[model samples]
Target: MPRPRGHPRSLRARPELQRLEPKVLLTTFTLTSPTRGALLPAGVSPVGGIVIDLIGEGGSRVVSQIRARDLFVGDFEGGNPPESRGNPGTIGERPGFSPAVVDALGGALAELSVRLTVDDGDTGPGDFDRDDNTLLLNGIAVGRFDRVPTVETDASGTAILSENPEGGFRNDRVDTGFFHVTDPEVLRLVLDSIRDTGAIVVQLLDDDPGDNFFDFTVGIDAALIDVDLPPEPQNRSPRITSLRVEEPVVEGRPSRVIVSASDPDADDAITFRFALEGDGRIEPSETPGEAWLTVPRDGTVRLSVRVEDDRGAFDEAGRAVVVRNAAPSVTVAADQDAIEGREAILAIGSFDDPGLEDGWSVAVDWGDGSAVETFPVDRPGPIPPRPHRYLQDGDYSVTVRVSDGADASEASALVRVRNAPPALQQVLAPRRVTLGTPVDLAAAVSDPGILDPLTVSIDWGAGEPSRIDLPPGSTAFESAFLYDRIGSFVITVTVSDDRQESAVLGVPVTVEAPEPVPPAQAADQALAEALLPADPADPRPATLAIAPDGPGRPAPAPSPSPATLAAPIATLVGQDAPDPAPRASSPPPIPVEAPSAVVSAEQTAPAAPPPPTESAGVAAGSAEAPDAAAVGPEAIASASPSPAVVDPGPDPDPDATMAPETATVAPAVGAADAAEAASSTAVAAGDDDPGAETRSGAMRATVLIVAALTVRRGGSRIRQSLRSASVRSARS
Candidate 1:
């Protein structure tokens, strides 16, 4: 039975008093986690019972008779099954404590006693019928509670949980409040004797000594009571035992902060609220006392936090730290109008930085196959212009990288490398030349890059340019002159490279006027043409004339000597032929284009020519034929091999004389055929463009060659005729 609750009127007799004012509690004795056999024949449910004894102030014991509350079966694993009934530590039973309330022998409630009980070893319903198995017997224990969440000794403390606890409609344990104590100091005294008793246990035995069953460990428990006691020591707020913010929190970088806090109340749950006094963020990590804090920019920041307990108590702590320097920010723009082969300069457009003294460097990649250029900057100010030289033309992406000691940023700008036009060097031709004189034209060209192939068109202030000899890997090209008319001429040279980059240059040259041609010379020129060649259908022979060897030598007059007229007398072996027909000539210059002037027939002369009767004339066809006293020079030149059919080979020595055999041509029908070929060539060329002296001069040369060939053949024929006549006479 529970006694009424009351506090003593006075402690004046406290020293002599054996116990405090009376108190009562609904006592509970439960058998839980009963393992072994429950002292039965096999592993089965046990009929449990409890015996409660309240020992008051002076160790005086009061035996309380309470039949086992749950006298039913339990499962094989030492727990009561849901359908069966047993004691698995469910509280709330008959109120039966403090019978003598306080023992008279002691001033305070001294001790309490509990014993577990189970039915006898008999199975089934007869188990608990025998009263002899009412109480826990000897020293051997049956089983134990494997795990316990927590245990406490506070005055109003509640047990977290013990093994084998249960709940019902009005559950005894409410959220970890399984066991409660009104006055822990009094309870401590009550349990003092058993606490040090070293693994105290409760067990029961059957008649068979060999099979010891129903052995269990009965635990000491706290009880709910009504008592008037001093207020519990106030719970203390959680403390920041060691608040540490890792140093060197760089801008935009994560830094670690650890908090060490504790609550004075052992059961208090601690939590932390982190905040920052700067432009930063605090994120709680998975770990309880750790967090990550990041500041966006460089500056001093304060990390403040509050450690709180479940109770309304808290402690605040804060720390100030300077964030490390951030990478300096700078805006970059580039010069788009960059010229090739010249320095392309980059200008720094704008800059924004937090650290004025941060050491920084800027690297520029010109992207023009050049090396990267880097410049060190002491601080945020006017950065020196970075420059690179691009030798080739192109569009480039200029990459600019700006880096402080710790961080770097990159920007790109598109820069176009304007193509550099070809450079025209000095023209190597003479400033002055005689009229009708073949001029050599040349000028140097450079493309401002590696030696690249070039296209060149050189105009000697005259006619169309048919060919230009610009060798591979050469910087300059040459063109021989063919000025139709002489004057103060301006030679134009156009140059270009594969990149379509072009340049033009003009060079002035004065052509001195020529002495006039006499009427006689004109007559000679006309005669040279008529005597030049015969149409293949009908052929004829013409007269020969010799030119003055030098200005001091008198000119030789033209005359139809027997040797000259004998050209028609020459005979062939197989049939009667007037003259060896001249080889066919190139198709008449088809006027493919109406150019300003005619193309000069490519020409070569190893040396000056000799008279027709000389051994040299008997051999090679030389272009320097005294053109019928200087009129056939053009004709003879035309008679020489056309450049179209010949590989002009290597240039020959101008001062070296070619052997007559060296220039020997095929069988000739006098110089007449050569002259005819030249004449036709000249007529066609002049029809296209008359007064083209370059063509006329070449025609004159070809004529002389024809006339010389005719004479040579005539002489051979004359000898053969004489030999035939003499042989006939001897045979007669």
Candidate 2:
């Protein structure tokens, strides 16, 4: 008989007698490497397209393929002849047999014989012992088999027997060869290993090439192998601590950005890259650990700082620092006591950043056409305020500019510069007064908003000096001066209030002279003569020196003697004296004389004859009367001479008698003396010796004396008469 294909055959002997019908059953088996089992009967195939279903009754199935080298029967521990594929004559002498296969089969039987005794089977003539036992070969019954046992068949008759006398046997065994390998621990281990390497395993499922079975293979091609790379340390968020900018950061200045992070895992050493956000530029820094960025001039910029670690972790921070092209502000103020045209101190206001490493400077423009002053402030300290003076009058604008290293600020002050002199308002007292008269000088000074105690000075124009004092309204400057000079004089008054001075004003003063006199020539002369004296004989002369005898004594009267009368009369004569010869002779008298008594030497004897014409002849009984008659009958006949010499003298013409008594002096004087002597003697021999009679006689003597003296005077005869009459009347 030919060995059945795809199945194992056993060699055994069987009895010739009945040919038992074959029974067939399909069973599933899981085949795997290191197979250990008895070969299947001839002409049978394992179930489900498997060469062998190596599975427990209710356990998981497993399958594996053996490598070509490990598939040889000699690799097994048991000595069993390899199964034949061609016709075979005996169980051991079949074609295509290997001796290792036969020995493996024998060894398997010997092991089984040790465990159990063999069983007899039917045999025929020419039958050979073959291992073809159909025992209940539970895989669990057999504890373990090193190698599968092969079976041998005889070709002469259909009988199977035990070839090596170790019959087929049953034993308790676990089918460990069919390893139910669902080890979750092993899968976990594999996955952990992959993870440690930073890799991931991908499983690929495919149909097995030799069967319709699903198989799994690890796809290392798709596996992600994570090498021991440092994890990208969690990206640290950056923080901006502060922002600073210079006075003015131009294009040349390198702006800075500082970055910080809170990542403990990050190394302090970092790589920095700076970018100015929003239209900004950056220049690579030449210095180590420095990031430089530039802000474009066209627009403002916000800077961003990016810091990266060696592990490719990065942090970003941003801040804004302004960049400007304009200067800053500086203010200026003046002290309260500042004065115009004098030194004034000013307070320059605060600056933004006065302290700078580079020196700072200040420039001032004091509004006037003056030179600008520049001061340097290199450090932080109190700057001593400076003094400034303005001369012109008006409001002024003061500007101050402070410069830092790169920026500056300016401030302006409307310094009201009042260089104008104050206005002078004058107050005056008694605006009008008399000329050449004294008056009180008063003046008041008024300046708007000025304090009291204003200095004042007055030019009174009266040769008085100026006075200075504080005025109470219109204060009076009392000074007495006579304005004798007559003209308009300007009284210049000037005032000053220290802070300002005023102009001088001139007030005009008028002076005039007193009034003039009237004319009355005659009356003036008469009054002058009356006030003076006429002659020395007249008690007082034209100019008198009347010496009072005592306290109450009256002035003495000069006696009326010839010399006394002649002296004053000579003065008048000298003033009005005619030819001397004409005045020397007696003047003719009037014929209206009373009859005169003849007082001859015999007058006592002659009460004798009352001779009228005869006595007249006696009175003129001389050649003088005849001569007076011979010269002119009228002169001789009207001759009225003195009783003593009228007849002897030249006859006074009647026309001469008509002349003033000042022309008839001799006749008048002789007659007046005779009369006076007669009265004196008569009074001496008064009848009763009466005082009244004495007084009458004295009065008559005075009258006669005055008449006689007056008749000898010149000028007018009427005037002499009136004067004599006035004297007589006054005495009476």
Candidate 3:
């Protein structure tokens, strides 16, 4: 192991002797040969040991060296001098050392300071005493167990035994201490020896061997050295090049932040961390450098990411992410025409960005002072139908609102309600009726839906007014009025529903006067037929031209008076016989009232008949009385009718002369007698003829009054008075 002759100075100089870099060593040593009761035959002992030199060109070197020890004890029971132990033996053996020489060196020897640990199970002494063991490394005493402290148990609960009165049993008592090689001379001497020997030595021996024999063994589980390898480049803080949110940062929406960083030292591992300033959820993503976060509900959210290396150096980056809410948009529509009592449907539609689709609700206001209703919406689309009813008739504004917890939008529409009026179906009434008759008025009315009570009114035009109320389901109304006067009239009907809607209709009515009758027995019969009474059940009131103590004002009845019959008979004859067919000739002359004067001759009469003689009238009147010459002509006719009236005038005297006197006397007599007979007949008719007489008298008075109104056709001087003549007499 000596240096080679004339080698390079670097190579020749021993590492232990030169000013060199510090090195580390690890040695594992063990002793197992001394069985439980082995005796102290203290010549030499073989201990298996190895040296791990941790310094070489590649920074690692292992040299296994078997070791031996020699114990030359005088008394042998502990208390050996430190100089006598002289470091038991070299830790790693030289290639040529023998057993005695190995022990002679006192332990493994090397030219270096050392720090070491020893766990000893050597039960060298049987009991506690002044004698104890001493430990050495490189011939420098390091530690001692002088008091022989009580054995402590290991992790398995077994007693850590030392040299005791009984024996060493299952002990791993640890004694830790360090030794420094500070003396240059001693270090040189040891280095010279290592140049020759190539080993380091450590030892344990009895301090007072005469009293405590060295009969125990020890094992070392670990012996290590500390050295400074080139210090790794100081760990550099990780660099954060970029940091950002991966998706659009919509408020309340989930997204992620991505960070990019690097560690300067290749041996350093890195990790990422994230944080936010405002409301949000942040977590690590699948990727190491990315973090997941929920977007905050604010103007801007601060996001920060930190990259840390294994050496605890970290770098951080911050970002301000703009946070926005997706404002919802909605539209509202409703049925245009809504009835006051009917239900209406409102259609609402809405939409939003996908991110805000959840946690949203819809609200509707019916604008009629009703509560607003809210409905949760799971998806963005049309909202469910909203139904509402309006009690009042007017225009109402409807609104729909859509909100996504954070934002809202609204739309409005107009819902108008209409009021319908009542309808008038018809007005039933008679157009014409006689005075004093009652007119019935009726009407039919209706409204759109089931209506409230209806009010019906009629203006009967003649000052009679009537009103009636019909219940909800009824549509008919009736009224009655009597016409007091003879004239045209109008009736107006009005129908109204509870809502104050109304309609009106008009009807016309007319009333007329009755016809009059003339006075006579025959006329009385005619009047009876014409004025027959009406049926009782008739809705119409009885009518009469002449009112007498009735519901209406009474009017005067007409009086009966005589009417002539001669003119009517003469007119009948004139119509039945034509002038050419039959002519009464001069052979017969007709008497005015001969009971039935009949014409006998069929010969044509001459155009001019000679005037009558005065003596002709005397003879005609004297037939009934002698001395007729003494009576005036008027007296003679008043006395008695000529036989022509009592007895039929003979064949109207075919021999009768055309005497001017005859015509005068005969007509005068007949007139007087006819007047008397008419007067008598009128008296006989009595009460029956009173109404007819009244009517006839009214007619007569009307005609005379009409005649008086006429101006005379001739000169005023020729005017004559109209005498009060009997109606019969006037006609004759």
TM-score of each: 0.33, 0.26, 0.34
Worst 10 residues of 3 by lDDT: 567-576
Give me the overall lDDT of model 3. Answer: 0.41
Tens-place lDDT digits, model 2, residues 1-732: 122142212111112321123522221221111211222222221111112212111111111121111111221122223341111100111011133322222221211110111112111112231222211111112211222231222221122222222222212111111211122343334323323343221111111111111111111111211111111112222222333344355533456543443332334455667777665566656653355555534236676665555544344556666654434445456523345546677665544451223566888787877898889876534445778876544576777787764667777777665544444555454555566577555554454323324566777776775667654233323334467666666677777655546657767766665543323323322232232212332321111111121223332232222211111111111111223342234223222211112121111211221111212211101111111111110000011211111121132222121221111112212222323333433343354434435433333332232222222242344233322222222221
Q: What local distance difference test score does each model get?
A: 0.41, 0.33, 0.41
Off by over 4 Å in 1: 1-232, 239-331, 348-358, 380-384, 405-407, 435-437, 444-453, 466-479, 482-489, 497-501, 508-732
- Once superposed on the true structure, which residue ranges of model 2 sit more than 4 Å away at CA? 1-192, 195-199, 203-255, 259-272, 279-284, 292-302, 306-454, 461-494, 499-512, 517-732
TM value for model 1: 0.33
How do the residues 154-188 of candidate 3 rate in per-residue lDDT, one tens digit apiece? 21112232223232311335322222223445545
Model 1: per-residue Cα lDDT over 63-161, one tens digit each = 332233333233223434333213222211223223222322134433333333221122222232122222121232211211111121112221222
